[model samples]
Target: MSEYFIAVIIGIVEGLTEYLPISSTGHMILVGNMIGFTGEKASVFEVFIQLGAILAVLILYRDKFMDMLRPEKLKLVNYKENGLSLIHVMAAIVPVMGIGYILHKPIKNHLFSTNTVIIGLLLGSIVMLAAEKFAKQHLIDDIDKITVKQAFLVGLFQILSLWPGFSRSGSTISGGLLLGMSRKSAAEFSFIIAVPLMGVACLYDFLKIWKLLSISDLKFFAAGFAVAFVVAYFSIIWLIRFLNKSSLASFAIYRFILAGVSYYYFFIR
Candidate 1:
């Protein structure tokens, strides 16, 4: 396939999975490997495309973000004590920022493999399923109702998402659900958390690989980025609506099947 064709395919995968309790990175890596799109350029492409998804979040939540950016709102330290603000989002990003920075090289070099992704998918699936079954408190329905404790704990759970297939959305949503957040609220919070997490990650990777890209590579990146942005915008809208009346069991089961299939193809075969 042409690189452009592959870019569109991967972009679709990234957009559909980025906010759906599925790991976009894991899916991109798997599909990339299958199509022989591995190496520095492909890795950089993957990271760059994530920015598209992040942009979708920013556009979708512009009102909330604009409110947080108000000079008055910027003064707060913990927004949960007041209302949902940039502070709350920053707090939720703390754990991932610290942990992701320390482990960045290791994750890129070693954990991006198929076997690691399969393991991550299986483990994350179990966590999500268990969280749903055990959650006793489903009282917090509003995103503003999220407390500091919940934000910090959700950030800690986000640490697990650094593992390729664990999924930032999946881990954080499961953590929120376990901590008494209603399903819709948990999913919404997960989307909000993604903006910073992916923005920083994409920027970091772009800096590392920017000097190496050719014009062709740039074209591929642009195509992928545009496609991912459009698809992710709609995907986020659909997921939030779906979660209002549905459960995450379908995603968990899908993860299990993905893990089994990956293992069989990449190892057992």
Candidate 2:
């Protein structure tokens, strides 16, 4: 396939999975490998394309973030009533970010492989199933009601997402469910936290690979970026609606199937 066509294909996969508790990076790695697009250039392309996905979140939750700028909104005890401020976002990201930073080198070098991603996919399905099965009863449906305690615990689940196929949304949503948030609420928070979470990680990766990029490559990157943004915009909406009436069981099943397919293709074939 032509490089631009590859970008579009991978962009669609990134958008469809990026926020769905199905691992976007895992899908990208597999798709890239199949399409003959794996390497440093592909890595940079992913980092850039993910930014487009994050932009959808920023725009969708612009009001919540804009509220953070208002000085009068952040009274000491209003965390439960003000929707989500920057504080909640920070709480959800710190644990993962700290641990992720420390382990970044080792993870990037050793774990970004099909074998490891298969393991991550299998493990993450269990996390989702367990979260649904043993989830707390008192549903904190509104993001406005989320507390620092809840957010922090969710952050800890995010640590699992440092593994490629572990799915940041999957891990953190399970954390949210286990901590008493409703599934929809958990998915919402997952998308919200993803803005900063993805932004920082992508920025860090971009800095490392920036010099490898060429001016001639801008169009390809733009193609992926634009496609990811548009598709992710709608996926986020569909997921929030989907969670309201359904459970994570289907997604877990999907992950299991994908993992099996990946293993058969790479190992058994």
TM-score of each: 0.96, 0.97
- Which tens-of-lDDT digit does each residue in 58-121 have in candidate 2? 9998987787656755765665566677788888899999999999999999999999999999
Which regions of candidate 2 deviate over 4 angstroms?
74-83
Record all residue pairs in model 1 with backbone atoms less than 3 Å apart, i.e. clashing: none
Q: How do the residues 1-269 of candidate 1 rate in per-residue lDDT, one tens digit apiece?
A: 88899889989999999999988888988888888988888877888888898999999988878877877667765444567777778889998999999999998889989989998998999999998899758989998888867888999999999999999899999999999999888888889878877888888888988887887677888999999999999999999998888878889999999999888888888
User: Positional deviation of 165 in candidate 2, in angstroms?
Assistant: 0.8
What is the Cα root-mean-square deviation between model 2 and the actual structure?
1.3
Report clash pairs, candidate 2. 83-144
Worst 10 residues of 2 by lDDT: 72-81
Backbone clashes counted, model 2: 1
> Model 1 compared with the native: what TM-score?
0.96
Count clashing residue pairs in model 1: 0
